[model samples]
Target: MYIDGKWKAGNSDFAVTNPATGEVIGRVPDANEHDIEAAVAAADIAFADWKKTTAYQRSELLYRAWELMVRQKSQLAELMTREQGKPLKASLNEVQYGADFLLWFAEEAKRMYGQIIPSARENQRFLVHKSPVGVVGAITPWNYPISMITRKLAPALAAGCTVILKPAESTPLCARAMMEIFDEAGFPPGVINLLTVQNPSRVGEVFCTDPRVRKLTFTGSTQVGKELNGLAATNMKRVSMELGGHAPAIVFPDADPVHAAKGLSLVKFLNTGQACISPNRIFVHEDHAEPFIQELTSRASRLKAGNGLENGIGIGPLINELAVGKVDGQVKDAISRGAKVHTGGQRLTEKGLSGGYFYAPTVLSGVTEPMRIYREETFGPIAPVITYRSEKDVIAMANDTEYGLAAYIYSNDIGTAMRAFEALDFGIIGINDINPTSAAAPFGGLKNSGLGREGAQEGIEEYLETKLGGFAI
Candidate 1:
């Protein structure tokens, strides 16, 4: 673990195993409360000088980091694949995505603008200045480990706030690798600290309640996000959460079935459907549902599941045994509830691949709203396709869930697409586009999904607090 501007081993160590093969690839230090305290204190100390540094200086350092990341992209990608069980190509893309944020935010740092407010008095002018929120506690999840870390760190750094990062225990290697790059890029001591620990709840409590930490940014499930929000409220610490989602992808009868199927397939199973933005439910018009289901099932059958490092592997295994079991249970539950399994709905137990945690891409038809898979978040390769007769019914169904992270609409009609885009209650809506998240756009959720946003100008603002100043010039 790297803490207090230095890389040092912890008192105790924990094993980081490969989710696919169940092999221990590396060991990460289990950071205790003392370690968390040290990391937080280091960030607190670094905040004064880091925030005081000129925006140009901060931007230059971030650019250097971005360049270094690009140079070391392959290594980082390999680490991500080894730890997170994502395909190598996907892993590489994540590394690039991670670097893009740093590059984008580097430019954004210089553009952090304050506002001049009109004053009531003739002699006085009101000026609003944005300043760093002080030490930030960043807790990131296992899926898309590298990108998640950078998404939080880039904006926090750009805002001149020092951070203490707690990466998920399942995938610590990628975080460690990124920290090594930060070291190589010559970030000032205490600017960014990394702590690896198994007990995230304990570490979160320490970080959230600590007076030194002024802001908390987390990416995980809704259940955990709520706890963190409450914990941070005690100290009135600023919070930014990018939590869970049960995103809906609605396919219209007039839309091209092939195009819509392909687009929805990519988002439905990307990262094995582990992403918060991954579309969990598919609402197809009854007229087009059959052909759409057939095409989707065929596409899923062709996907080759194997080790992420190997070439031509379209899909990889679930992150661990627990994830596989959860997916399996959901499939069985749906089946028991009369949901028709079109193809691949069970764990893959073939020879040579038995050691890894693998599940075949699953699709279900005739799924009703009452089934667990219909309304709940089954964060796996399982996609439930629900058919609807009317646009009003589908729209209401899409907005039924508490989660409102993202929604997808596939329609050739401009007016219909516009209505869906406007009526759908989601933070990010995509029209005929499967992958909508980018460094240039704001990404987040509404309602129970999360609070605040990540990426673009909105992301950087979460780490900063505005102060108003008035004086007669």
Candidate 2:
């Protein structure tokens, strides 16, 4: 654990394992309530000076950290794959993606501008100043441990706010590695602190109830986000949440079924379908269902699954046994409800994969509203297909869920694409594109999906508070 510019030990320790091989790879501090309090207190004390520093001063430190990340990219990527179970290639890509945030936010720190407003009264002038929101408590999830931390941390630090971070227990090594870089970058004592706890509830409580923490940022499920949002409301602290997503991928009638399927297939199983934006319910036009299903199934069937350390592996093991059970249960429920499996539908316990929690990539057709996968967010490698007759029908089916994080539309027609983009209720929509998020663009959700944005200009605003100053001229 890192606190007040020093390494500290917890009351006890917890072992971190490799999800691929189920081997104990590393151990970290299992922080207690006292540790959580100390982290919060340290951040609170640091904010007094951190918030007063100029944006340029902050930018230089962030730039130094970003440079160090790039210099040690291979080491970071290897650590992520060993602990997080992502393929080495995917981990490498994640390292670059995560590092981009620090670089992007470092420049953004210099652009925190305020404005002068024209007053209705001739004798008065109005000025709006943007200042840091003081201490922030951030809780990040395990799915994308590297990127998730940088996504939240870079913006908070760039906005001149001190932070107390709690990384998910499953992947604390990546977080600790990141802290090492920040420390080497020469951040002041208490400017940033990290707690590697076995459970997050105790730390989350401290973040929500503590009066010193003025903002709370989290990336996790909607159920937990609601709980934290409610807790944060007690102190009226600013909050930012990037919660669960059940994204829909719609293939319009005008699009070629094979091309559309290829596009969706490329991203549907990304990160073994653990991504929040992975397409959950695929809506294909009835006229092109056969070809789309055939192509998608073939692609999903060919994907190689094994330990991520191997060179040519397509996917890796699920986080643990519970994740495998969730995927299997959803598949079985769909199959029982008359859905036909075109490819895999069982756990993989064959040679070389018997030790890990591995599930075969599956594609199920004839999935209806009655199936669990259609409604619930399946954080695994399973794709459920639902046929639609018209644009109106597809839109209705896409928006039927309580989540509105992301949606995708594949259409060659300009009018069709534009109409669907405008009609979708999701915050992030990709028209004929699977990967829609970037460091330069705003990313967030609508409705129950989440609140506030993560990247781009909107991301930094989450850690800032605006003050209006009136002057008599």
- Clash counts per candidate, in order, are 0, 0
Ten contiguous residues with the weakest lDDT in model 1: 346-355
**Candidate 1 regions off by >4 Å?**
none
Q: What is the overall TM-score of model 2 with all chains considered together?
A: 0.99
- Please provide, for model 1 over 1-473, each residue's C-alpha lDDT reduced to its tens digit, 9 standing for 90 to 100: 89876888888999988877888899989988788888888888888889999999999999999999999999998888989989999999999999999999999999889999998899999999999989999999999899999999999999999999999989888999999988888899999999999888888997778899889999999999999999899889899988989999999888998789888888888899898888889999999988899999999988888889998988888888889889998899899999999889989869567889999999999889778888788889988999999999999999999999999999999999999999999999999888888998999989889999899999999988999998897
lDDT of each: 0.91, 0.93
Which residue runs of candidate 2 sit more than 4 Å off their true CA positions?
Answer: none
Q: When superposed on Cα atoms, how far off is each prediction in RMSD?
A: 0.9, 0.8
Worst 10 residues of 2 by lDDT: 261-270
Candidate closest to the true structure, highest lDDT: 2
Provide the lDDT at 296 for model 2: 94
